[model samples]
Target: METSSGKKGVWAKIISFDLGATGSKKVKFYRQLFGFHSTRRRGTQTRRVFTPGILSKIPHLVLGKSVVAVPPEACSQLLDFLSNPQWKPIQVHVVDGLLSAEQVRRAVEEFFSRPVRLTGGEVPLSQAVRAVSRRDAGDPDRRFVERLLDQLGRFEWLKEAVRRAKEELSR
Candidate 1:
């Protein structure tokens, strides 16, 4: 991962590389990792101490083989940066909570010209990339469609998109 100064350092590698949100919530994980804190008064409030500078300081995040789990707000900027020709080959795994499945799919497809699949659970980066690449191989099998539906059904936010995908498949 390259910092804003165009230099690779220990902080960049440690945070953007190995520190991935696998089983935990992405927002919470990022906050804790970046030293930001949240509190509840009458309503929930988050301390904006370290977040603004942290993200700005890191322009391009290179996860190598690891999956990149970023906050929803940063998704657009990350996608834009990674859409460059040099970064095209990298496989990205956008954390799927706040953003709808369709939104993520559209963003990725628009940027990378590849379809997105919701694994419904944590999956190896290689496996997820292979699944998407297979879907792009022209004809999709019924079994693949069925499995995709099953995975999409796991997330409530993806229910509408799943229905749309089923309809498209039926056609």
Candidate 2:
């Protein structure tokens, strides 16, 4: 966990490291609802290969030896990990610091904890709603789906979860 110990009292935190397409976001989400902290983001220069072994190399973000990973891969990989080996017993919540990218390279460039907005600045709920509606129908291409989700701002529920996960990340 990266910390600023030079000043102030010791603040124990759970720092979650999210490496996505756009950038690497390291945030410490306090258990108290709405409390959050972020790390200086590292932007991605290239898209990474999504091989399982390769994907495991991200430095283990362990809380006393417990490790968790929300990999930088396709949604299918997330599905496979969940179904095949039952990777994550439960879904982990995040503040969505990194806005999902349309292209893998773009995802690599995003910063962790930097939420993506649908239009100008704010995240849209419409985009999220549209994405779910389209994806549920098995639409082949959902390019516009993501746009709609951002417009919908459907991720409002994730705020507290992200905060809790942040504590887990930092530990």
Candidate 3:
């Protein structure tokens, strides 16, 4: 896994290639060859693909969405891979590193100007709540919220969010 320059986020692959050269020239050569951009932030250098433009060059067979139910910022690190275009033969996987199925589908569809299907299952309610709330609330707390929401007739908030997401994706 690769962490983006103390950004405290992890990516699937972090590669280091030695061209036998040092300094900024090496960074330039690497960027020219592989299209990975390097940035020096707070005295540390980090390599990343900041924009979707570089995705035009990659041949992605499949795009995968995660079922972790994390917020957008938590999974923003995966944009480099997710924004790539895919072909018919490619198969998509619902793995870790996405905000939500409908959101990603909408993004991919909008960027490629094509209808796309995102496959994923509902995250476990407990897991979903924790990830959504960004906290490690215990069972009693979760149960309390569930019961309170049910009593208040707002228990369907998650489902409603998903439905709204689908509606957004359709546009």
TM-score of each predicted structure versus truth: 0.26, 0.17, 0.17
Cα deviation at 132, candidate 2, in Å, is 42
lDDT of 3 by residue, 138-167 (tens): 454444434433432322213343444333
Question: Per-residue CA lDDT of candidate 1, range 1-171, in tens?
Answer: 345766542221112333334444545444432334234345465422222223332222333443443433455655565444443344444544333344444433322222223434333322444444445434444455457556545443344555665555554
lDDT of 3 at 58: 25
**Model 2 stretches with alpha carbons more than 4 Å out:** 1-73, 99-171
**Candidate no. 1 TM-score:** 0.26
Model 2 poorest 10 in a row by lDDT = 25-34
Which residue pairs in model 1 clash with each other?
none
Q: Which stretches of candidate 3 lie over 4 Å from their true place?
A: 1-14, 33-169
Candidate whose lDDT is highest:
1
How much does each candidate deviate from the true structure in C-alpha RMSD? 17.7, 17.2, 19.1
What lDDT is reached at residue 139 by model 2? 43
lDDT of 2 at 130: 35
User: Residue 123 deviation, candidate 2, in Å?
Assistant: 40
Candidate 1: what lDDT? 0.40
lDDT of 2 by residue, 69-115 (tens): 23332223433433432232334333222222222222222222233
